[model samples]
Target: MSNDVKPGRAAAIKSALESAFIALLASGVCLWFLISETQASDDGDPAKLTMLAIGLSAGLCAHFVYMAIAAKRAERNATLWVILMVVLMPFTSVVLGILLFNQVQEIEQQAREEGGAGSAA
Candidate 1:
């Protein structure tokens, strides 16, 4: 399948980066909440527990970003992987952004080749 990003969609890169950073921050905040709860002599507050759970889960998702990066690097399953990540956790947008950045060199090479070929004709 073609790997070309649709032309004129630069905003997606920015969006992904923003999403990733948010996810990371949220996860960190949640961890802090959990720690505070623990320090509080097992307060048993559902609200704190809920935030802790969510934060830990989101943090787990950060590791999954490698899949997104690979899929995009392979240029075969960006949409599918990206969608899965997003549906599973909103923070995965950062993964997408990281993938995009990681793939830039390859993308630039392909563009140059295509451009040269077109010019040669």
Candidate 2:
């Protein structure tokens, strides 16, 4: 019921944003590399495309990890989310991330309300 804000909440948000930015930057760099290295005939090369795909996927996976970690700090199940992301890839993870973020917000709001009520009493 303390009115003081949870210190980790802001840190968690900042960490999540930083992780997402890094992931996006990594993906963009890979894309740039792909574009620069593309020979006209390389478009047909399965290996090159496959490597690029892997790089992009890795970046996406990192983003998932960051989100999962942030959600975990907010009391979500980290292992479950990580496994779900790995098994189902981006789609399921994205959905779960949204749910987790909403849940975290609700939890924070509830905490604030309780604190305010306690202080007013």
Candidate 3:
């Protein structure tokens, strides 16, 4: 398979990012609801339990989606990059994502130039 993303794949990646954003928002809402329910009730409630489950699951899903998207942007040493991202999350991961994207863009540009040169030759 080609490493370069096609227009359709780009659209899919965009959709995934959008979905991940929504999932993250939902996770926050669930957390708020859980906190409120826990504060109001003296005893453990099924509604609160459900909210807790939803919040945790949504957060986990969002993290995985973000990792997958970032991994795709990494060309060289992708597995190592992904492993490091998981180890140093939040701040470091964001920085790594930006760097990885730049690396991928540079690689694609080089490939395009090489292809053009070959065609001309």
What TM-score do all the candidates reach, one by one? 0.45, 0.58, 0.52
Report how far residue 61 has shifted in candidate 1, in Å.
5.9
Query: What lDDT score belongs to each candidate, Candidate 1 first?
Result: 0.61, 0.69, 0.61
lDDT score of model 3? 0.61
List, residue by residue over 41-104, the lDDT tens digit for candidate 2: 5455678777987898788778777867776666667788777777886576567657756655
Query: Residue by residue across 1-119, what tens digits does model 1's lDDT show?
Result: 35684333233443444555666677777788788788888567887688789767867576355445445544547678657776865455555556565565456567678888999
Number of the candidate with higher TM-score, 1 or 3: 3
Better of 1 and 2 by TM-score: 2
| Alpha-carbon RMSD, each predicted model | 6.6, 5.1, 5.4
**Over the full model, what C-alpha lDDT does candidate 1 score relative to the true structure?**
0.61
Please list the residue runs of candidate 3 whose C-alpha ends up more than 4 Å from where it truly belongs after superposition. Answer: 1-5, 73-89, 92-121
Least well predicted 10-residue stretch by lDDT in candidate 1 = 6-15
The predicted structure with the larger TM-score, 2 or 3, is 2
